[model samples]
Target: MQFFPIFLRSEGARIVVSGGGETALAKLRLLLKTRARIAVHAAEADPKILDWQAEGRLSWVARPVEAADLDGARLVYAATDDAAEDARVAGLARAAGVLFNIVDNREDSAFITPAMVDRDPVVVAIGTEGAAPVLARKIKAGLEAWLPAGLGARVRAANAFRPEAEALPQGRARRGFWAAVFDGALDGRAPEPLDRLLEAHKAARPAVGEVLFVGAGPGDPDDLTMRARRALDRADVVIHDRLVPAPILELARREAEIVEAGKTGFGPSTPQEEINRLIVGRAAEGLVVVRLKAGDPSVFGRLDEEIEACEAAGIAWSVVPGLTAASAAAASLGQSLTRRGRNSDLRVLTGHDVNGLADHDWATLARPGAVAAIYMGKRAARFLQGRLMMHGAEAATPVSVVENAGRPEERILAATLGTLATEIASTELTGPAVILLGLAPRAAARSLPLLQEAAR
Candidate 1:
């Protein structure tokens, strides 16, 4: 919360770094990434500075900075350990109308250098506003994994087509053309400018925007429902999860702009407010956006909020119900949740904190003859199962956990309900998961052999 993030391009900016020690050298190294014109001033410097100067990478002044040094410079940094000199240099830099960072003296600074992660044209600046540098670095490290490797190239590719996009007629048709590009259709790998021109001519037909609420299933691509697969093929943009099957994403229109709408609890995320804004923004632009969710959009998918947002914005949205994580998990084990004549009820629980409706009876999930399929309940398995015992469910009831269900590399671990805690704790599940509880599972297990033989 301390930092306001930003990204700035320094292509034409003149940057002057005043100092020569390791700290100054580090700052200069980061500045080097900008491709900005650079000048360095220091009484003495590390060997790396001399090497850089010798290579003509940067201009070096042997003496301290002067008034003229700040002229026309966009930014100046004083990293000298001497507080007095740092202040004097900062004061002079400010007078010259340049943004300046004074080493370790944020109070006297006109500008504080933000922690940055650069991927040209896709730079991410982390500003704690001078508060949490460690948190900023941690955030940067996390983002490194999520950001694409060739983002700069992809962004440059997007930029290259702006003029053509702007020239296209206004309305859904023009935006749809760009939507195809975002979906990876217009990449240089595909065709040429002529093809785009041809497509534009064909696109004179009326274009209308549609919304598909797709269930991402679990973390396995094969777990995707038949309808989901077809939906993905028609997707213009996939609003997906961190846990959605990667292969599923790859199957979508390659130029599809993927918006990470997954609510990964690990860090701050696009609030529902902003996500709703983004969804309506792109949809209003006439793109077919797939509002992808991890499981069945009906089963605990925050459809209420999303639907309300769309209705408020007067955008057309539709739900394409998917196999919820519970169904996929149960199916992976060949377990029929609503097995005829036995499990009269099939229950699904959020398992996390819930408010409203006079406090949920968590113990009902443990009731016999009712299949209890827990979604995202791993964290509370011990407590959940224990509550089941208190409520009269057998301690040795059959329990199965399906991880990466329906994947080619899928793994199913079986244990008594009592031992699920140890199994889940020790199980090497690296993706989203589901928990199943039922007496019918034993019968389901018996059917797997026949099912396996049938597949052959």
Candidate 2:
């Protein structure tokens, strides 16, 4: 902030150089494009500078700067070996209402050029404001990767569309149209002039309040439906929960602001009401907002309040469903919740005694040939099994304990209900386990290979 940032064009302007070596020659060659009236004061000249003098590209005098160097000079550069003469010329320029730069001496000069990134006519000028040119160059290099080579052409293309945007009557419709265009959301060349299309776009602007409920899905990112991916990509801002992994978050647009609502079982979570505010606020700003939650939003996810808020705001929104962990767990273990006549009923429950198991109808668990998917039932499996047995349930029932379902690291334990405790005790696996209980048909059952000897 301490350094002034300004662009200078020396065309038909007066400027002075006080050096004749490679440094001065290089500076002079760059200035020739500006068509600046440049005069050099040096005792000796480099070969390039001498050739330019012979060709009349620039003019120079001998014995460095004397009294005559300040004549009509608007700017002066003290790029000389003699520090004493550089200071004298700098002082003269200062008294003559001129800007002087004693090269490399920022304290003694008015201007200090920076190592710039010139993708002109789309130049990105990075300056430390003369604080640190080296640091400025480093910053420029980092930006070189993301910036396209044809950025100058892209800038020209955008400028060409200014006429189309201005021709439309001034209003929110017109402003919003351009806002969506130059918002940097779209890259590369502008499309063909589609005036007819613009009218349709302006007329069909999206609702002010609309929520896009996105499903984070079970652990794996690939399991996310195509609809879910599109929903995330269109989101102006994302209000994501904890279970949504970092990889899934990367799929969102770079400008799509991300806000973490620590809704995970254990984490630094954002409060629910605040999350609701963020989603609604972004949507209200005519933004496509996505609320990302693990599993389907309507399930355990606090979709109730979010839905109510969206409804109250009068926003148009939709839901994108995902593969719930329960289904994933069953699929990973090659088990089914229902098997034709084998399982007449299929039940899903949380064994964590959400409030109390006494309130739960444990007697329904005694039904014959019924399948049950128990979520987070690893620790309470034995207690639930005891309840089932007491409720007239058969002691021998096929059960598969699936953990880390449908992931690269999936494991399953197949055992009878009576040995549930003993079987789970042998496996040290933990974290979000599910239990699939029922009698499996032969095709669904997993069996070890048996050696069959053919007598030869």
Candidate 2, residues 1-456, lDDT tens digits: the string is 666778887677878899888677766765775668878888988877777778887887876776667878878888886789889888888888788888878887788766656565666678776777778878989777656676666557666767776756554456456555544523554544446546765577454646889888876778889998877777778888776778889999787789887653333667778887888878888777889987678766778888888888887778888887778866665566666767667777777643644234678877777778786677777888888888887878777776666555555666777888777776676555677777332344434210111111
TM-score of 2: 0.53
Poorly placed runs, candidate 1 (over 4 Å): 1-208, 219-227, 266-268, 354-359, 439-456
How does residue 234 of candidate 2 score in lDDT?
72
lDDT of 1 by residue, 1-456 (tens): 433344445888888888899889888888887778888899898899899889878888888999988889988999987888888889888789888888777778876777777767777777777777899899998777666566577668777867756766764456556555545432325433534653664567665566788887765676677878877876777887666766778878776788787665445566788878878888887778898887778877778888888889888888887767776667666667786777777777655643422224657666666677776666777777677777887877887776665556555667677887876777666666667777324445533332223334
* Model 1 CA lDDT for position 70: 88
